[model samples]
Target: MTTKVRETQICLVVFIGLPGSGKTTLCRLLLEFLRTSCKSLSDILHHTISICYDELIPADKFRYQDESSQWKQARRGIVNYVKSLVFTLKDIEVLNMVNSLEVAVREELLKVVQNEKKTRVYIIVDDNMYYRSMRYEYYQLAKLYSFSFCQIFVQCSVSDALNRNSSREQSTAVPEEIITRMAERLEPPDRQNNPWEIFSLTVPSEKWTVAEIKKISLFLNNAAEHPVVMPERNNEMCQESRRICSTNVIHRVDIMLRKLVGDRMRERSQTSVQRDDLQELSKAFTDLRHHILEGIRTGTIIIPEDTYEAINLDQSNCGHRLQDFLNGLLTIS
Candidate 1:
């Protein structure tokens, strides 16, 4: 008799640190570490992990409202939220990252959680732990969801982090005031809640070093298949991501098809009313097509527009006709 193994519940990991604090670096490392660990322990060869960044959420729409338990996902209309998912959500109009803290957490984080049920996924939250000292909120989340998580803080001297960010070909992202604010409120993790074993050089029991920086870079490369944003480039990345899968990008060449054929067909018909009769219109069109086909087939050219205008269209539509339509729909893609 063969025993079937049940699927393991997914683990959610959230990293908190200020800008340049190395949350993004740790996230990359964790992805590789998680993949290796899953394979070794479960003997699952093709294990999958999905990492979602908090700032990448379309925050403008899901504005962070005042603190209230009612700010749960159900606060919005069902049909409206679904419509947002198809376009308005992904192709966000506004690009601001500020939101009501609690509400932002609920709506955006929940969206990530719900969308990640496709496989044995690892949900990584890449936010600096600038707010709450203990990750009790995360722990409560884990308890509610029947899975656990680890908090990794990439500890560094604020000046050192700030300096490292400055020297990179890239740039550091946080405003000076926010960095100062985070530092003032920063709390080093203690023993009882030693839940998150931090890593710097090797989980940072002290401060960061040149060797730690190298290790973190190596780790992030293994974590993700895509170049997800690291906060500073969040705006640029979000727009590019939206464009890559945009319907507008894919359909631009056919734009005139809508205008010339069906779009302006009504206007085109008025001009064609003087063709005397359907037979006359059809005969003129036949000759035009014949001429156009000869140009394409024989390469003599110069006759396509003569054919097009003979069909009662104009120079504006030199190549876009029935033939062009066929080439678009069937041949050239």
Candidate 2:
């Protein structure tokens, strides 16, 4: 009897930080550390590629809302290029797809692909992924491909980042304002909140030590060994879950509105309000509640489902809106 061996899986390491946070430098040090220090990892690792957004996106396209679509396309293209490289281990098709990339980037990619053997690979994506949504995109990609995903948050203060930016080459350096803005918006991995980001590490850019490198290598090794398992998809179950959630939200809102309407009716009754007017007010309130509930069910009204606090805040706002409607009805009566 022959023993069957499991093949090594690909790992995608996403770097999240602000500009001048030393993500690119860290990438270099990590690759070198893995290649030299971790002999076991180096043996199975066919190639380690670093994909820097600075090389892929133009300077003018940075930190601008207007260029978001372009940024998205570029990021998607990079992922596609990586997928092509992994599946085909060839750069010809990848190059044709990303011909807009810098010639130097193209050459480097070609060089790496040419040297790659049939073995496991690690891809480090270097970017100032300041938003959780930005990192989630890569996470989704990893989940789709059943690949191991990990995030490295390069921690650096705004002042330190700005200082580092000042010392860089004029052409390569980012503006101080962009770095500051990105730092303000940076959402570091919260493993507790996001289960997908459980395999995450945070490293101080100013304190790079052998111990830190070892820790990073260990983290990567663990992540690579345990690739993300794709969840079983059940459309019927998903639809049922959504229906139940929607029903619950509508029920809560209806109860709140009924209480508000009852209170308003009692207040009007104490003031000798007309019976017809009271009935009309009740009907109006019922209609408005129905409209609001419908909007929630259809997602026409935005409700934050991620946290109870957000839902409470939204409910408070809804209560205020309903109160205003009651006030308007009273004035009309």
Q: Which structure among the candidates has the greatest lDDT?
A: 2
Top model by TM-score, which number? 2
lDDT of 2 by residue, 73-125 (tens): 66666767666654533223444443544454455445444543334567788
* lDDT by residue for model 1 (147-177), tens: 4355556676788667655665532344555
TM-scores of the candidates are 0.38, 0.63
TM-score of 2: 0.63
Give candidate 1's TM-score: 0.38
lDDT for predicted candidate 1 compared with the true structure: 0.40
For candidate 2, the per-residue lDDT at 283 reads 86
> How accurate locally, in lDDT, is each candidate?
0.40, 0.65
Q: Give residue 20's error in model 1 in angstroms.
A: 1.1
Q: Tell me the deviation in Å of residue 259 in model 1.
A: 64
**Shift in Å, residue 57, candidate 1:** 4.7
RMSD of each: 25.6, 13.5
